[model samples]
Target: MRTHESGRLVQAALAAITAAAAFGVTACGSDDSASSSSSAEKPAATSTPAAESGKITADSANKGKSIKLGSKNFTESIIIADIYGQALQKAGFTVKYDLNLGLEDVANKAVEDGDIDGYPEYTGTALTALLGVDPSDVPKDEDAAYQEAKKLYKSKFGFTALPQTPFTDSNSLGMTKQKAAELGNPKTISDLKGKSQNLTIAASAECFKRTDCALGFRKVYGLKFKKEIKIDVAQRHEVILKKKADLTVPFTTDGAIAANKEVILKDDKQLFPPYNVTFVLSQKAADKLGPAGQKVIETVQKGLTTPVMSELNSRVDLDKEKPEDVAAEYLKDYL
Candidate 1:
């Protein structure tokens, strides 16, 4: 067995290497295989997408007015909103924040009802969850995928789809370092599909039924586990660490993913939504915030990436760091 000190050193090195040059695994499978994909492995993927379509033009109402920025009830979303609000303020636009606004329905409804002018969302989610697309499955190509969503949003909701950051934070598979090493340097989702039957998984109670979690991954990926242990969302990491499960399904941008350098399995098949947190504004909010809103969103996109966002999330949600202070520190980097 490796010494604890040796393990710690190895983990530290892995974290440093990944932070500088991130990696991803992409497999080609269908929705049916998605839920079962845990049993397979695929080639490691580079996070860069093929190409993004240009932003679509639309009618806007800009008049240098202040806007209320709303965020969903999650650490990362609230952090992004803070970054955005700060950016807007820097650009001479008055900004208000209603942080932790729950899920997209709440945020989208608020915008539509004119309670708030703008918020952030992901492309795949914006299409299916917000716009009601069929299948409710995630898209394979980020750039091409969001274009369909962009059109849907403009035609249906009268909202502007701003530039989407190239960050995908969603449900995914992960393995322990010891397990990874014992498996002889496992790296792709395809590699695990056939092997998952021998391992157990632990996750939030809802994960077992969520399309992106146990369902989508198993259906398309063809992974069959020995067992799945349902635990509270906050207890997932502890369960995994205690060896209750061989791997855990965690959000891609989760702080745990970063702090522990947990190996995120490559989603050879695009099974989960691209929750890149796109900035959006109501038609009226756009008219009022205009260039101000654009600049704020832009700064946030530059400042927040997968690693940085994951770290910030851990600080607030896991470490119990105050949200406002966390936001201030991140904003200082760009402000």
Candidate 2:
């Protein structure tokens, strides 16, 4: 965890590093295993069709010389890094691995310093943590958020995000399926308007005042809670199960939603900015990867969907499977 001051210090360091480095790296991966690293030996891989077309042919570029993949310390981040690393390897690039790169500050600074090529990052994380944008200032819609993030990264940090995946691990309002059906099968946030006053909401103590939380709900969907109860997120589902609260906020990829058979309401009015997973890379690295590497990354992005990512997360968080194994399984059809 980082204090606001520490976070800003990291942002400052990243800005300095980005300015100093002459070469940058891009991330790509999937399937065959490789050891983790801040630096490591090149992993072996077979060429895929994308690489065979000579799109990522070694002779075409030499700035970075090698593609080094980095990932944050979470299961999801490690798995994503593997996916990118494997794809680049199959695309016939000499790839290196750097998993468990700590928090966003550490990871972003590593990228800026040319310690690694690229990594998967969420838009919301970048906006608030890196760009210093307030949560309320984040664009509500996904495309708009991505576009704005791209511009912010380029202008502020000397880098940009690759084309984004369709899946977004964003905040969502959830209720038991039974509860939703009882309310005439409410599918969108707007559907809860009239009935919300009869319901209790469960969230952190300060959520009601946050523009991206209760305040956004009230303004965007006209929601008015009968009671606002401070509840720890881990116990949110339990509260609903015990009939203490009618609604709770859950991450879109939360396993509890499936376990409890809860339905996440659609944010039809786009009150919250969606955090689509994307590859964050510097222009130096992007140029090195050339058209072939870029195509591979975009292909991987096209394959990911909300349900797909949720299931992948469940396999690790709920089933306790190795993220590498899960990612490899998904990559069987990923390209």
- For candidate 2, the 10 contiguous residues with the lowest summed lDDT are 18-27
Q: How far in Å is the alpha carbon of 99 misplaced in model 2?
A: 2.9
TM-scores of the candidates are 0.69, 0.65
So what's the TM-score on candidate 2?
Answer: 0.65
Best by lDDT: 2
How well is each residue in 62-131 modelled by candidate 1, as lDDT tens digits?
Answer: 2244668777655677666666665454444545656555567888998889877788887766766667
Tell me the whole-model lDDT of each prediction, alpha carbons only: 0.62, 0.69
- Give the winner by TM-score: 1
Candidate 2 deviant stretches above 4 angstroms: 1-42, 46-64, 134-137, 175-248, 263-269
- lDDT per residue for candidate 2 within 1-335, as digits (tens), equals 11112233333333433222111123333322322344554543433232333233233243235788788755567777776765566555677878877767889998999988888988877886678788778987888888888999999988868888877888789898878888999989999978999998898654565556666788777788899898754565788888888899877876668777898899888777778888998788888788767877765545466666766666666666666666655655333
